[model samples]
Target: MHELIVSPFLGNHLVVRPGSPKGLKVPKHRYLELQQAAEADGAIPGWLHKPVLRQWGLDLRGQNARPALLVRDTVSHEYGRASYEVNMACNWECPHCYLGLKEDTGMEWSDRELLLYLLRDAGVLWLQLTGGEPTIDRQFPAVYSLAYELGMMIEVLTNGSRLHNPLLLSLLTERRPYRLTLSLYGATEESYDRLTQRRGAWKAFRRGVDAALEAGLPVELSVIVTRDNEHEIDAMYDLARSLDVRTREYNNMTPTYFGSGETLSAQALTRGGQRGVFTGCDAGHTSLHVDPLGMASICKVARDKQLPLLTEGLDGLSKLGGIADQALLRQGGCSGCQLSEQCSTCMPLAQRYRQANAPLGSYCQHTPKEVTTA
Candidate 1:
């Protein structure tokens, strides 16, 4: 396993340790020097040796201490983050899942490889692997390996159904992800199984969580709340505390990506917490999202700007910024709304709410009191 990676982040270069968030910024000259040292099998540069030990607790003093340093040679664009949905297939079906239809489909191995390289050329240093459940995808391991080898920090957003698989666990153990974000439906078996609409989902989820923690993998839990398991909300928090792992709560519900209101019925009245007022985001400017078939979009919620990455290659990203600008404009239902200044929901998300024919108070600032309730 490689000890550290050197890649371009936005405009600057950074030396980042796998499975860790902490990173050290390096100048262009030092970045080149480190690349040369790694390639020529030369001595560890004096400047890098101490920081490696101090930041990650890895020593470079011993004669056999040859830390595998992976360096990215070029970055043609400035995109620093991206999310790829490996496949739409999942083992369990939750009522509130934003992905309306879970289809077992994805790009072939050859196309998958091409997409990873395109991401590298586009300067994506932080890559997220998401899906209906990324672990259940057949090509997940290979995709993960290729991303890691390309020096991109990886975060796997999974449902935790297949984490207990020995072969999958072994691969993750050898090449750790920056973080494994597991979604927790409920604290108890009845609630868990009922909510996911699967028979043995609770048992499988528990086994996966236990195995992941036991292996000392970096794990974080996303406590998801819905009408089905809202009764166990307090118990869910207690369970996370007992497990002694990092956790966050997700209570906000949105219409499915396909513009369906079917998922809105599962929304819980209890507010999990504040997500802060949404000012704006660098969706297409610094980050982009890719679906299962290599189609690029501005962001998950805003699908108006679709780019054919497989056909256009990295050149497609150049148009994303402009697409982002047009999609974010206050138009349609939001045209000339006085409350647009203090609105928490962005235009793209508001558009989804409108398409679903949701309640007037659900996403519109026109109903201020209801907007704050969730």
Candidate 2:
């Protein structure tokens, strides 16, 4: 007779049943709910001796599946940082936007909430919420509040168009993000609107930025460096300084997942044209990216491919490691190059272009030509 077991791993939660074709990666609370329900019905979370798994030729790292004796990690108590694309659907299609404008094929709201609970259970200390625009999601409030209640530090990247939203602003003021990074397209409204291609976006953005500051939410600004707005770098700093907020200057924009430069317009410069070598990036180890539909990937650059964490359970997770390994491997000239620290190659950017045989899109003026010449 086959038995049912619930185990949580560092990467995923597994509910596996012997002889079953598939299992689910359940959320933490739901898993706990199942635990309580089992206890009520008088059954311990199923556990077999470690030898049983080896005997069956099964190789699995169950984070916290405690048998009468604990072996491997059965349940994970370690948490770090994660950035979820709350939803990929967007109102604005920025020319240089990485993910490109696409329908929300990501997970539904219900499942996302489950992921959040599971994330909390996994001990995630900081959570970054981003999207086509996270505030556009109807279920944003529920998700945001749940993460906040979990005591996770929240970082939000947004266009600031919706900060003035009454319900959302109210939620922001109450729960409050640890930091809100606002995208500043240009210093002037006309220039900003031209870049975003929205007629009244500057107004909405201004309103949102003002609203966030007025509500006492910590705010920072990112000046996107593109042809249309590259000249406004100093002005952007002035703007940030005037608002008494910190600023980040962005020069690189990941190409569309297809690795085509279709989205790259004059306003969006290519920041990866140099012959730089990939050193390393913080995709798999330090940070993970989850898209709208519960598809998890190592980073934003790898968004097109994702592991279905909930459906395939442990098998999906195991495969995900392989994917990250393949992605993290130093490809091309980077393998022999010693200028990794100086090379302009961003791992994600290199990975994005290498598979497609596509040329790196644009060159950073600051790239040291001699260093990458190798």
Candidate 3:
């Protein structure tokens, strides 16, 4: 459990805490000084004494002040954030899951370590650990600890199934992820169990949520609105209130990553709303994503192409910006569309909708001038 993490973030020298977003920038020389100090049991640098004490409440001047610090190596190239799918195995069978086939396998220990180190070297500071259910992965703790040690602030996206497990709970409590996002299927047992197709799922979820909040973990609830559970949406919000945690709602469903429309069947027809204007995104330019097998993509949705991280290593990321650029272009089905300028869906996402043969109303604007004659 290090008190401070000193690393290079997006070409800037930064000092960040383990479970917090607040960061302070320091000069390169000072960053190098702290890196050297971390290697030896030397005095805290005079320039850092006040800011460190004021921010973290650690008195570097105290005789007993032996602040545990971790200094990460600088990277020549990098992104600011990334999401890694730790595993595809889940304890529940929610039909709305966009993963399609869920496999219970991941990289070997050595390759897993390499992936984290690569992420570190690529300058990924905010790392998200997601999965079919990341908590259930046998190697989750090791993967999470390695990412933390590599000076990345971690966020975990889980189905809330294994959060109550003693070993897993203890590990999370001690390490303290910046946030633990749990997906809420329904407010009560009947709808929840039916929706997830897992008996006693509501009970397990309640236990996990309670234990996490009681343990002072930063927990957020994601209310997944679907046809089966939309009736209980109000109750779901009430449940989040009762638990005194922040909550977000997901009203629309996307097709499977493989372009299958099966998962979209769960969307609540009434709640299927328009996405905000797709001005643009910083996907590969400022952020990236990686799957369980070390396949790096621009993001989760536009994953038709990927970079094999295990094979190409960090240097391979140089091509990611080009991939991202191509994904945003109005090509294929969207090419020559009249309303493309103001369209909310990007080209890659529109491609998924078209692949599924989804109704135009599901994603495209319904105006008369929406599309041009071919």
Candidate 4:
């Protein structure tokens, strides 16, 4: 017999069955039995059973037998990787932006010092530089250079608003195998401007994209679903294809704690309630968010001070035990969702719902309700 423990975090149940070198084989009937037992004992929510079963390879009809938990502690350890968000200053004011606030003035040396301490101490080998716009940070090159010196694989998420700076472009060109994730607000100027709420932003973003391409940087484009531009998804996809870029990644516009949720909701409702309930989130366990203040949060959208698992130093992080044990227990709205597979339940989206005191209006024309249905 294997001892299986189910812990909830960010609305998903992490099933840990200890002492099983081989993953445990769980049949549908047995899972249901566990669910009923837990529910009767007030230990688990009924809503969770479906998603957990689905995640463990149990079919909807509950007919599948012997769904095993294929466990490899070594594999699990390797899956545990360290990631950090370097900064939170961006150049654009897109309505769906989620960095909390804009501060183009750049980070002080003290801020950089804290970042360096955290990165070094955490043993972070993979890093992500995100911001209101990371390239807009005057110290971005310094930050990038330090990460490179530390031999960390770096990924940058930007709006492409400031990619044309010659020095910045040169730095990126000199860095080999770096990834640039660009946010495409719209496929055309009319839609783009409306989404970003800034005139000439469209042109600037285009130039930035071209510059990144010319610099030979590996680039990936992300698009946020909003009411004003749902129809343009295919158009953006076509544009990415034309640029010899990969497919446009789609994210549901989530509101953050800092005054951006209202704008995101307005855009979502205007787009005919395309955004809906977020059912699944993988923060705290597989992914983590580090704020500009050096606080480690389970999700970027939910910047709860109480959930700061790690402060701004590697020493603090190491003292917290293994990264796997730091997984956050799920709470609030995410606790009741059933569509763990199809829904985009992230911190930013959760923050929007928290701000609105209601569910996010739909902005995803491409996501059918059935896809997220329980």
Candidate 5:
């Protein structure tokens, strides 16, 4: 059973147990002093009761009590150590996308509201906003504004196509938080265009990067490892060095695809004729994904909903505990395989390959196993 308590500092409602270590404590004299102060300031209404200080005591006397205090205590211990994904939309259509494809409609407002409330309530100080291109949504700016107001430092992952627009640059310039991550598919236009699948996307992305740099936005670059561009990794780093950005900060490419499962296949992905599951992920525990539909998922790579739809509010996110636990278990050929750390084995992608005849193809094939892990 959860009991609500009002925090003295934030003045927000927090659900905790009466005897839990996380519960608020007010001495009798202090309580009386606060009550008197409230009365003097005319802040006390007739509905307000007299101050009553209660001592902390565990109520373990009841039958059928299933360690409520223990559960609450565990939750409190992990209070601020959670991560969230705002959405799964991207402007580019890279060969490897874990979240699947974009729907005809945009994200619902209810889902956004639920995520906002949850982040605020859970005291999540950092949030990453992703998408088919989070910036493509007109609501992107508003969401950034709200995250800022609530004190969360926002990080954005984008293909850098929209940042070329002056208005968009100005908006991002005004409300900067951490930095924007730009995914670089290739160093040159010909190479980049081949990966993006859209003609002129390379030019647009380059211009977007220039706009971001001109606006003085802190930016990072991410490259996806693919057979087409695997040899260019060193050159990409050289380009980063010339740009005067942090070259060491570059993220190695992963072959995780974002759209429909129909795009990738296991036969195409298997290396050395050995099919194995991707392992060593604490995914459901430390990370979470909130899809456009407002459903909570473990990893963007997996389509399964670990928690119920967060329509009620942020508090509903607590329901994800069971899903997180279940994800720890492995099945099929993935069981007990040692390649977990080196392979970008996404369950959704594997399922997609199995459903269709698509093969598992990723930039990982071009990268050395050690370097890929590195």
Candidate 6:
């Protein structure tokens, strides 16, 4: 079971990031008072009944079942929710793919088990598994099984191509994931093939989703917005809703497709321009992305500048400062830009401004004149 901590944060209600527990503030002495109350009658304050709070392990019955704090002299470290990019091996090669293609060098199962053990030890109650196509991994089932057994609510991110595989479907049926987030590239068969550049992929995606839903597994769809299928977004939305579950729209393929030196399709460029400010990135501080080789970074975009988690373990936390530690852009395109109040420029897209080959302006075509200078 996951455990939560009550600690002080930015002068308001508690803050709960992905991998960390919810931190609720109380008068210092009131902390013990609540714990005692929990012990006496499991009386969790009504304020603790936020849905997200309950998801992070707060007992609504007012019972505080968090593990007793260890009497350690060392200053504590925060390790909350985790995301593991099990492999870069995907079955599809959509033109907009940033990493180019998947690599075959897989992580060892022993190390995989070890990573799970470490995460569970750190009180990780949620684990997200994504990949080029995580199901393509031969050992995916084993790794996912271990995570499930560890009591972590598991989320599998897939391109929806191979969910129809018998073995993978069997495993999913057996373990039953918290949710299967299907990355939908298009609304129609032709559009899916055009966007994903895979023959019969749309058929496979449908079969997979149907299999999961038929097996009584919860499924959600997130349409991957790209020039190839941008026009079909509404159709995709209608399709998603027809499935009778949650649905969402993802990336316009602009800032997200940075670093690969690829420009957006003229379509994606025009339908969307940069916003006045954009700061939704929640990498290093809240989320951790670990590649198959054990390189852990704040997010997939910043993987090149990552730390090897196998060697550093918890001690590596100090070295994992994300966007804040990054140097100023060459022209300082993102520096002192209050447009960040309205600017969509984040570290990954900001880093591209320094790349001679990068279509920096294309990513942020809407930057106002005054805020353009660092």
List the candidates ranked by TM-score, beginning with the highest.
1, 3, 6, 2, 5, 4
Q: What is the lDDT of candidate 2?
A: 0.66
Q: How many clashes (backbone N, Cα, C below 3 Å) per candidate? A: 0, 12, 1, 23, 28, 14
Worst 10 residues of 4 by lDDT: 70-79
RMSD of each candidate relative to the true structure = 2.8, 12.3, 2.1, 15.1, 12.7, 6.0
TM-scores, each model vs. reference:
0.95, 0.71, 0.93, 0.63, 0.63, 0.74
Query: What is candidate 4's lDDT per residue for 84-203, written digit by digit as tens?
Result: 555555546666665546654444666666665455444443467776676766677888776655444567878887888888888776654246888887789999988778889899
Across residues 105-217, which tens digit of lDDT does each residue of candidate 3 receive? 79999999999988888888899999989888889999998898777889999988788899988988888788899999998999999999999999999999988988888
Q: What is the lDDT of residue 330 in candidate 6?
A: 26
Alpha carbon lDDT at 16, candidate 2: 48
Model 3: worst 10 consecutive residues (lDDT sum): 58-67
**lDDT by candidate, in order shown:** 0.86, 0.66, 0.86, 0.55, 0.54, 0.64
Q: Compared with the true structure, what per-residue lDDT tens digits does model 5 show for residues 1-374?
A: 21222222222222233212244444444444434443344332222122211423433223221222111111231233234444455566666555555543445665666566665565454467777677887777777777655545567878889998877787677666466888877788887888777889988988898888887888888755555666677787787777767532323223234334433331122122333435655555545666666666666656455455465455555655556566545444445545545556455544444444333343222233333221
Residue 102, model 6: lDDT of: 55
Off by over 4 Å in 1: 62-67, 272-275, 365-374
Instruction: Identify the leading candidate in terms of TM-score.
Output: 1
Better of 2 and 5 by lDDT: 2
Answer with 1 or 4, whichever has the higher lDDT: 1
How well does candidate 6 score on lDDT at residue 36? 56
User: What does candidate 2's lDDT look like per residue over 1-374, in tens digits?
Assistant: 11344555445555544322244466776566546544454333333334345444454344233231111133344435688888777766678887766576556667877788666555455689998888888888888888766545678889999999888888877666768899999899888999888899999999999988888878989878887787777888888899999887776655577576555564444332434444566465545777787777877776556887566543444454467778665566456545556656565566665554544335222334544634
TM-score of 5: 0.63
What tens-digit string does per-residue lDDT give for candidate 6 at 271-364? 4553555546546764567888887777666655778777787677556664325521323555565445555666565665345254556555
Indicate whether candidate 3 or candidate 5 has the larger TM-score.
3
In the range 226-315, model 1's lDDT, one tens digit per residue, is: 999999999998988898989988887888886788888888877632445668899999999999999999898888669999999888
Query: For model 3, what is the alpha-carbon lDDT of residue 129?
Result: 96
